[model samples]
Target: MRVLFTSTRGAGHFYPLVPLIDACAARGDDVLVVAPSALEPVLAARKQPYRIGGEPPREAMDAIRARAMSLAPDDGVSVMVAEGFGRLCTAAMLPVVEEVCRDWRPDLVLHETFEFSSVVAAERHGIPHARVAVSAGGFTAQADPLVGPVLDAYGSGIAERLLASPYLTRLPVSMDPSPYDVTHRYHEEPRSAVLPDWWNGAKEPLVHLTLGSEAGALPTAAGLYRGLVEAVGALPVRVLLTTGRHLGPRDLGPQPPHVHVESWVPQEDVLRGASLVVCHGGSGTVYGALAAGVPLVCVPLFADQPANARLVTAAGAGAAVVPANAGGEEPTVLDPDDVRSLGTAVERVLAAPSFRERARALADEMRATPSAAELVGALYG
Candidate 1:
């Protein structure tokens, strides 16, 4: 079958689609991936036909931050979601989505939900379309088991439409590493099992911490860093922290023996060996932990993080503390709003065995998931 996999604009957004793309190709399906202008070469290297365009990364980040700052005292998810809807609908994603659909004329349109580009393309083509959410916004692919309550709770309108679609295939509803049963190249070859770096530091009951790429760049980033450092500084567990390239070791202040902070570390590598993760709940980090059998303590700072954290709590994985724009909101890295408060949350994750148990259970299931190529068989075989 001819398939087009359209992803959102961010590196975090598009990466999840990669495994599925590889799987489909391995299954002998013709696949094309539409991504941001910067990722075209990345896709080509993976052997997928590629095209790229749309807003640059910083532009999108700026938009999100501006909208976030404008939100008044009562503005919350509703405001953010409403604002996001406007930001997402654009001529930018349209050109590529339209062009790919027109040229490929695939049997189906598979897309990452936030990749509003693909969503529009699917609407334009009148082709059978399936949604692959990089996060839990995807109620589309869930089993009949959880569908009823969700539909009943939220109204069946949107969920019903997806469930009713004979052609609408779905990836698994998960916070991290999607449970998309599809075709991929990862399964065809031997995956190099490089565990996340935290393992090298100490032993199990491991604790992983990260503030996300954007969190570390916020004006209040330095204070946030100090808080994170103070929280885990002398803790018994090994801590691997990522500053998101916004700060270097010198800027990060003093470090403890247990904590090793870097601008980047193979996240998946460290998560693979971690027992607990403390993060800002960017879907990438959350899912990375899930894919690796590690539970999370979600410390959401802004944007979709709270929502992402909500999913983590619902999944029996984690909780959120130090809400964005809360009275104690950190204004700059130097703003002191009690960064060490985050440490208590870390302690909770380490002490809570249930969190680890739930993560392990989910990990066990994830490990058994059919690759994207195999998912194709479930639908068409």
Candidate 2:
């Protein structure tokens, strides 16, 4: 079978599809990935066959960002999703995606949730397509109403075709108990990486701090990073803070020997020694922590992070410290009180053993889910 996978620009949007992509390739299927130019380096590193597609126009993105600033956090996210991804990105990529489908003649087109162009192109070509979820909560339901009209403008019933496609997800049922008739759950094995020499022989409990790639690049990230450093640094545990790819470790200024700062670290590797994870509550981080049976202290910044944080807290595996006006256009600047809250939450999670127990239970549940390779066999074999 020839499989074509599509995605938008960000790492969060692309990384979730890796397991399925790898599984298909391992099964000897002819696989091709279509993404933006920004992802070329990532694709090259993974050694996947790929083609670059159009990206959202700069002016349109600026206009959308300007508009999103005026709305509430959730409302702002809706606008960005509806106008940015649903409309602009789809419009930009549809032509190129359609051309690829016409030429490549793929048997199946798989896409991450936000990449609508693939679904439309697949529908146009009468090829089978499936959605690989990137968020932990009910992101599809939230996006459909906002995205449906935009997709319909391109082609009648395009949004319906997207909704009707087979849904593949790695989120354990307990983490997101919402029912979906088309849902197929799979387990993605954790990635491993060689840790730095400094990370070796840490006697104290390890705390991993990260805000994901996109969130770390936001204007509000500096304040949050400083706040995290100051707040978590006071704790007795050893802290590993990743500044994402956008920021340098020196940007966070001087740190004590107990607080290790790096530009990036493989999250799965970090989780192996992490007694607790403090993150921005992106779905990938939340799921990774839970899968590793590690508790969390979520500091939600924007987009689906608030929802993901809520899900983790609801599951009893983590606690959340939401900033004021999170998900809005303006960056979330943490105040002194917010810093205190963050510290208190971390302390609470570390001190309470129930959080760890709940996380372990969730991990066991996740382990029982079918592997990505197994799902690939069911889909293509």
Count of steric clashes across candidates, in order: 24, 0
Q: Which regions of candidate 2 deviate over 4 angstroms?
A: 197-200, 325-329
- Scored by CA lDDT, what does every candidate get? 0.60, 0.86
| Alpha-carbon RMSD of each model | 6.6, 1.5
lDDT tens digits by residue: candidate 2, 78-109: 88889988888998888889998999999999
TM agreement with the true structure for every prediction = 0.75, 0.96
Q: Which residue runs does candidate 1 get wrong by more than 4 Å?
A: 38-45, 56-65, 72-89, 138-192, 195-205, 245-254, 324-338, 367-369
lDDT of 1 by residue, 1-381 (tens): 888887655566676676667767778888877776656655766877777757535666466646655554224333333334223433456676688788778887776644444545565566776655544543223332333333333233433444344332221234333334432211112143564453454663557678876566677677676776676666777777778766776787777667777787767667656778888777778767766667787766655566677777878876566554542333423223434556677778778888778777766666665665676677655
Clashing pairs in 2: none
Model 1 local distance difference test score? 0.60
Best by TM-score: 2
Scored against the true structure, residue 199 in model 1 reaches a CA lDDT of 44
Candidate with the greatest lDDT versus the true structure: 2
Which consecutive 10 residues in model 2 have the weakest lDDT in total?
A: 193-202
How many steric clashes does model 2 contain?
A: 0
